[model samples]
Target chain A: MLIPMAKLQIAGRREELSAVLEGIYRLQGMQLVDVARDPALDVDAAGLNDANSLTQARLELLVARLDALLALVGSDDRGDSRLHGDPDPVSGAVDLADVEAELDRISILVQEAAQHLDSLTDELAVLPRYLHPLEQLARLVPELAALPEYELQKLGLDTAALVLNTSDDTLVDTLRRELTEVFGVRFDLTSARVGTDAIGCLLVFSHSDSARLHALLGQEHVRHLPLPSAYSGQSLFGALAGMRTRLDALPRELADAHQVLEELIGPHVEAWHVTLAGARAELEQLAAAAGAGVTDRAFAVVGWVPRPHVARFHEALAALSMGPLAIEELPHDERAHSTPVLMKERRVARPFGLLTRFLDNPRAASLDPTGLMALFLPLMFGVMVGDVVYGTALLLVGLWARRKFGRISPGIADLCSVLVFGAIWAIIFGFLFGEALGNLGKNLFGDFSLWFYRGDANALQPLLLFALAIGAAHVLLGVVLGMWQSWRDRAHRHLLDRVGTFAFLCGMLGLAGFAAGALPPGFMSPAIALTVVGLVLVMSLHGTLGLIMAPLELLGAIGNILSYLRLAAVGLASVYLAIVANELATVGPLWLGIIVATFFHVLNLALAGFSPMIQALRLHYVEFFSKFFIGGGQAFIPFGKSHS
Target chain B: MDIGIGLIAIGAALAVGISALATGLAQARIGAAAMGAIAEKPELAGRAILLVAIPETLVILGFAVAAMAILLLPA
Candidate 1:
């Protein structure tokens, strides 16, 4: 059910506006309506967005900065938000400077550490490529070991490790020959094959002779192998030894860096979120203040409050002693927007409210379909997936999931709750339909059905008829609801249209029954009479347009009813698949058959979960909802709710 | 099977097969656009599934027609 709303005006002196707004914020009862556009306001309204621009800008900037800081900090390590206190927007503005100080501190420390950790990770990954070739070169050439012996720079010698790409086997020798030509025995080279297409060499030379040594190495088919950024500009033996030491220490350093980040960030994450939410809430309150109406002496905050909570809403704000304060209910201006709907339902129906809102919230003063959805969606799902074994499994899983993860995610909890209801219905229908892993019920206990076997070929016509009957009843219910809605809204033509549709559907079914010999011949005249009367009522309402669209709609409505055949078809598919699984089990070796049967049954169950649920929902959304639902209504968002 | 029965079987098979093909085509188009729309606005997900499922009614009707043909025609 949709709760009624009272359009309210809370007016007080300018000085009392902040305190009064704070009171309203704490109440979290009113959805603010902009005073300027509200025709319901008797006074000449003034916009407040321009009022106190500086403070609003400051708060907005604070929120942005806090959001940035929070982003830099990861989600709370504990994965629970309960550890944090709620934001208190009305407390004071003294913490802005403290927040700024914290932001600056986090920014500098995090920037340096983040850059360091990033480079370390990249270098760690890149370092292995260098090691493979260097190791290969060292394994092939034993003389290379002597190069690491030097504290090369202290000894005034430098080593450049090179991996040269070349098809020629003599490329290393040519490089050695070329280097000797350039420096004339000032350099010693130890070269070996790196891989099939390359040579790896350690060239030890005078540090002073490095410029000329590189000029020859830069020649085609021969270039110095690039080193990681950290190890650049160092001797190969020194870089290698440094890299080896770094390699050993890298994991520990990476862990230390992460640990440092966690220590700096983890504890304050929830606090930051709370602060961020508080700053945003304050900003929203300020914006609401800006939107509020003002005179030379009085400030008026116009909003909608739930009718049942109107007294409590006033009592929540009674603490504020604003001079000559008055709170009054204003008449709703039907055309001017700002009335939002809040759905009120029982605790059991609360979970299904999610599905209702997933499409759109019910329009203000319109019917809430949550109760209908809760009643029908699961029942239809049960009808489609009637199986005791599958239903039991789903029941256990749904219950476990609802209990375990419901606290973590409300959406998942809602889905799990819905699944539990659906599973219960499935079990009830399973016994009624006589299904347990398909025909296994029959094999176990001959004709164990409380009703009839759904798997029998003889059941197809009856199942189709049953499904159509369900569809017709559901469609008729939707039409009736639509008629009531139109009547309440005083949409006279829409009411008549729904009435005509309802009468026509009822009459058409009667005629269909007569044609199929389910009704006596004497019933034909009245059935035809009722249908003609309905068609005339429908046609008279639309004038020129009704002639074509009315009859087409008749076909469409018939098609809509026929659409429920999927319930039978899909159910039959599931049952036959199970039967095949059982048959395959009996035909093969016992162990192999058991395995195959288990595999197929599991596959069938998986398909059942998605297929039947989707089909049942489609029957409602398309066939049923089309008859009544008017979507695109604005959801009620209270002033104090997190703007995020 | 008699020739008349074979032809009736072929007609029934066509009734189901052709509509299934049409439904596949319609759903393919609907599903692709639905996925794209859902990627941009995830709140459209339920409606997207609804749109994707809407076309499958064609195949279901076809199944019904085939069932009628097999169960009622010869009788």
Candidate 2:
């Protein structure tokens, strides 16, 4: 699926070069190849015409603005942009005197507003305490002290009583005398114990004088204990708590003010856009003036375009009269060729339309093995997972997650799909083989022992044979797929190599069957003959040395076949784990056993699911990919707006 | 039955542990280098992550091996 590419060198006049580069930039889907600049070329001058540079600069500015907006929104940061935007030429060149005057005015206004706001905030903090009734009572202390000659008359206690610590008795006595003369009723000071604390003095008042005392206390200028509930021991602490509550509500109150500020600042932000447009217009004018003579300049401009966009690029160049610009096709070079097959097919098919355009023009290699990988990966996974119950559980979990999450990567989605398939296969194989919970054929399916050999003693040979057969099939499929791809590409040499590989595989299979008595004694003759043919083709396609060692290649092919036995081996291991879990669950007392069963089953399910998933992917990426894949293709990257 | 099961479990665990350790060390070393490159040019983060993940296949292979051992345990 990796597109084959060839490097090209382009030469043209400066103006013509710029036009061609611009046309390339306008192409919808193209990957630009990074070519080293010639030392002789003036890079700075050439870069001015370089469309990629302009695009990169534009993208950086856009990304910076987005980042600023995100920061304003208080979103998490995605790091900083490395590309610096051009300075605003007009602003940059402005006289220092003008800038200084403007700055001074703005600074003075900001400082004054900040100070006023701070003072207002501080005053609001103490407003609540001043409003309290107890504070009102304290204000009356001084007024009462001014009066002289008072006598005790009342003993009843009500709201008129003003209590004070004996520590400040002089102020209390003076206040009592002043209150008595004002109200025409004696204000008596009585000492009484309240709770465990000493009550220094309580001013008793008649019901009629109570109203007057309350009125005197309500006056402003009192520094009294705030409401008992509001007293926080220290004035600063109470003030701070009140200030914090008010400040917390400030944002809501100033929402409209903030909106106005944004409105005022919005024009300044838009000015950047105006500046960019002006710069672009100026560049266009410069280009127009240069005319046909622009091509005669000393520098060369180069750019990349996608293969599909080549026609459009050519049309644009023709319209601009920018001919004589050389164009080269970039080849796809991948380390593993099969990995991109699905992505490539998806690209060509366009099944999802614009939604998948990003995949087609990815900036990174879309190396995802899908087709042959689809089959072997699941089989390997099922074998490793082994238990039907655990596999089923994993499948259900994957299905639920996929449905809930909505969007997920195709690789992971495909993996889940494969695991589900594997689970189905495991159920059939597990039941037939009497491997339920690793008890073999004893207790499970009591009377149905015909489907599989009972216990480890009877199962070994049959399982080994099954493993060998599966390995043969897997390897054969890989070779066949390789051959088909080569034939499709019309690469005769690659086709011959694939054929050689197939024949070698067949010969090995025949020999193995013969050794196991699955074939006649004379089977070695066909195997040897086919193997010789395979070797000759391999040598002709590769080298003379390859042909000489064709027999050894056959032996190597046999070794690879043995590798598939691991599939069966892993399946057996999974069954063993399930058995162990079951045994552990049953070892404890009844109540404990229930708990253990739940815990062990969950643990086993997790292990079973993860182990198979990883192993299955490994078999495909390593064993299968090793045979015929090269997957280091540079992904297609188009020149356009990038989402940060 | 107990001895056989114990031996199999021990062997499988050991293999899994060794494989995991080897993979962990390999990934750590490769990942550090990839991270350094990404630090220099953050645009390359995606590519660097892909490269770093390549070495992680060893751990996967080890996991597969352990799974194989477990499957082959006498039952």
Candidate 3:
């Protein structure tokens, strides 16, 4: 049930304001509305500031611990289970203090290792300089053996390897061409810009292998001249790439270290747990101190306590000298806008609370209307569907779904129950009409057949008669319910209005029956006159114009009766469909017969099942519910912990 | 006899077609409104779907009638 709420306006010192709001928060289920303040008058509470800072620090620690845990879990399919399982809450709280200490230790160790690796790589980059002279000998021996003495002497002069820096492009090009032609050895130019306007190269045989080149490049002069570092850009990238294996293992290593520290400080976890317990106790005491007294403010703290808790909550508040807090009980009305069945009793007595509420409310007396609607809704549904086999199948399916799914929505469950009931009625009616599947006149009894017609006869008159009878009963029930609600509400005139309408409808029905010769002439003639007079009197009771509109009202009532014929039509259609399915199954070839029968029967069943369910609800909501129901109740909004 | 059967078949087809067209148009109108509401508050999807499907039952009932007419008539 929707609970009516009042807006509360509070004015107090800021500290006192916060204290009151805190007390309100402690109230189990009271929803506070528009809690505003005048900033100038409100003093910021010292305790609130302390609490805020403590909460912020706690949150930061929690985030850091979470990040560390995520890193340990890794980014892979293996980590999925951790996401699904509940974390050990005890372990979570214990780990926070250790995490900071462990992080500090690991950070220092990682920094030292990183620096050592950097120095080693730098040393390796300059190693080539020391081995250069040996490399020069290796290159010289291979080349000199192939040369003549005079050529060797000339080469020897060039071999002295002058390290003069050359920026002169012409000189460098001339030297390169001369070397290529005369010695068949390439000039290997190793250049360095020592300062502005200085460039240098060491010439060597192009045929010299890498081993000889490495040795020659390792010479004292090359080392002294500051040759380009071997581990410069390329080796630095390689070093970084290799470090990934180490970096990736960091989490596991830290985890192992953390494990060792955890074992060492295992007793400390207990000590801290004790400390936390003490702090919580202190906080609670402080909260109690703050809530010790109540000021004479216009507004009082309101909240919801389960019906059972109300007494205890009231006692507790009174103990604190807060006096009595007004408690309003809200009913759990599941329907979106239906009136709540407020029980005066504390204990809920029924399995279906809403159903029980209906039973209790005298205004809802229309719900148990003489079993006519109960009998008619299903009867109409069965007639509309019209197949015993299909109806039986629907009953079984609905029963199974109800049993298996337990309680779904009351609306859907109620509808299914109605369909199942209809199916039962259809089976009985199908037998009576000698219609199986859609054979309207087909005799299952063969020699015992009572009807001779083979197919399609106008059953409209009987069906229409049945609908009209049912419609009269339905409308009468509605009037009765309207009168009952009015009587319950003590609206005496409304009760008279309902009774007058009911009498008028009965009279009209009698007159029609007499005209059709279904009733005695004297009996129906008097009823017709009496009905007209009653309607006139009832209409005139409210005003004069009602007497003039009585004829139009009677016509409208007739139109309403005609609407019930849809029930018969839909029922007949169901039977007709079932018969067609059976006929198709019987006539077709063996395989075709099976296929056609199955498809047609299944199709018919689906159609029959859904059609009545909807139409049945429509009749109830529009025709029946409209008579007395005026739903617009507000839903109960309680202040409590949301499980979601 | 063939012509009689053909006429029944045509009638059944017409019934099915008209029913389906009616359902389609009604559903489109109701469904568009329901979808707009769903966009505004997605929590209403379940109830909206049920409400939108209510009128479509008439088409299904029509289909059942047409199927019966087709199969029951002599071929």
Candidate 4:
């Protein structure tokens, strides 16, 4: 719900201005509006001296550098963990010059340690690429050179080692075939898995065919590594020996670098975070003075404070009393457009609040759509998916994600909560639709339709009507709400507009009922009369332009109702995809069938999870929201709040 | 009868396919402009998605038509 706000106008001695502003900052409730904007207040706007300007620049520079430095280390609230039952040593305002000196000192050490850690990690990751292929070469190269009895080199047969860095078995096979074409069956090529991706190959071919072999390798663009030169002029065996030695030593270097970082940063990270936060808070408090109107003897600050916080605001000022100060609750200026919005929502509605905010903040005077959205969004999503297996899987996944990421990001937690609710609704709708993994329930239990099967073609007429009914209900509710808001705001034109839409929808539904022979013949005249009256009212409101506008508005409303057909369309799509999955499963061998079925079901499930969500959201954003939602209210940003 | 069934199938396919094509075309233009707007002001991301989603009603209406042709027509 949108919280009621009071416009607070504070006036005080110029000497007590800082104390009053600091007191308000501690309250953490009021969103300051610049008092200087009022031209009647003969006062300076910024009231910045050279000293304040210098302080602003210095604080900003320090805070920015600290932010970058802390972000690089991926630090988050580290100080709190270390301060268990202990007083915060870095509490209160920090001296800027001392912080600047300490920050610069720690910055150099952190940079060096971080650089060392990065290089060591890169070396560790790259070493395995070379190590695997070289091991294969070590086994082949020594045997060829040391076989004194064979004299293979004298016989014009030579061995050269190359490491191929490819994971494609087909490419390796192609290279083998090409080599055979060049050197015939006389050439021996032995290749082994060198690393996760690289291959180590030893080619033994006649010197006569060596040129063609090189050409073949070049033509294939075989991206092979030349023999490792751990030590130059070393034999292949000796080069592998040097690499083996370095591989053994690499881990030790990596460990040493890690230890260096731990030693450099372990004691200081928490302190640095605390100091950075304190400095930033102080900077915000100082900068908030720019919003005040300063005269020769007094100053003034005006802002909106939530109604519940008015008492707290009074208490904060009572504690900071130095001289005679006045804080008055100004009568709400209906004409003044500076009222910032603060929404207070229940925990159950918080996730929907996030979604509502995603579009834009609802006007303070307008309704908070969180409650309605919470009721409808997930329920509509469920109707689209409506599968027991998919619902259960999504529920489990959503629960796991919420547990895993809830503390780190509230936005992700809100999304997970939405998914969890949608999944629950999906489960309920699944049973109503009599679907469990498409028709798998029927196949297993021999006809499982508690209600009508959505996949059946015969359900199409009733399904479309059911969807249309839901659309009509939702649109009617929006019209009712719009009418209520119009009446509350005393917007007579808007009230008439919504009343016309309501009458038109009722008349249209009555006509549909009458045509289907569900209503008496006498009802036809009333329905036609209502529709014409609605049209006349709608048209009369627009005067001369109503001729064009009335028909357009009527068509737009009908189109909105038609849009709900997507609920049926999306549901049917999911059911058919699952049916296809089941059909494909029966086509192959048992193992292949299971694989194919699982693949298709997973694809269907993935689409069901994301596609239905988008369609459902589109229904809200495009169809429902267009009826009444007017979002452009400014979010309340309290003085001294950390936007970061 | 076979030729009639084939024609019905083609019509149903066209109902969905043509509208989907139109939706894709509309979304492509909207999405490109939305991306440019988002690049300039990241806060417009949510509104951009809504704009991109609006044209999908074309495909939805087409789907409804296709569903009618396939199911009601045969009956």
DockQ (Cα-based) per candidate? 0.60, 0.13, 0.15, 0.55
**Which TM-score value belongs to model 1?**
0.84
Q: Candidates sorted by TM-score, descending order? A: 1, 4, 2, 3
How does each model score on lDDT?
Answer: 0.80, 0.51, 0.51, 0.80
TM-score, B chain alone, candidates in order: 0.92, 0.80, 0.89, 0.92
lDDT of 2: 0.51
Which runs of model 3 end up more than 4 angstroms from their true locations? A1-379, A403-422, A428-436, A440-459, A490-500, A534-556, A636-644, B1-75
Residue lDDT tens for model 1, B49-68: 88999989899899989888
lDDT of 3 by residue, A236-349 (tens): 123233344444655565556555433433433333333333333234324432322234443323223334445565565445444334434433323323322222222211
List, residue by residue over A249-305, the lDDT tens digit for candidate 1: 899988888777767777777777677667776777777777788888888888888
Q: Which stretches of candidate 4 lie over 4 Å from their true place?
A: A38-46, A68-90, A101-267, A316-324, A334-337, B2-6
Q: Per-prediction TM-score, please?
A: 0.84, 0.51, 0.48, 0.77
Shift of residue A121 alpha carbon in model 2, Å: 23
Interface RMSD of each: 1.7, 7.3, 8.9, 1.4
User: Which portions of model 1 miss their true places by more than 4 Å?
Assistant: A37-51, A70-89, A98-111, A118-226, A233-248, A262-277, A319-323, A333-337, A536-547, B1-7, B73-75
Evaluating just chain A, the predictions reach TM-scores of: 0.82, 0.52, 0.48, 0.74
lDDT of 3 by residue, B6-73 (tens): 88888888886897799888889999999999899885664465567556555645655565576657
User: In model 1, what are the clashing residue pairs, if there are any?
Assistant: A48-A290, A49-A290
lDDT by residue for model 2 (A1-644), tens = 33432222345665455445444443433333333332322334332346645544554454454334333323332222321443332222223244335435544544454455455555456555434433333234444333332211222323233344445446655766666667655555543332242233334456456566667756622223333333333232233345457657765645644454344333334343334333343343234222212234633333344444466655765576666665544243422321122244443222222212211222223323444454565666665565546656776876776566435565455445555666766666555665555562345556343366324555556766676787678777766766766665566887787788789778867877888799998889999888778877777765667745655665556655665655665666666666666677678787887687667667767777776665555445444554554444344444321211
Q: Distance from true position, residue A516, model 4, in Å?
A: 2.9
The DockQ score of candidate 2 comes to: 0.13
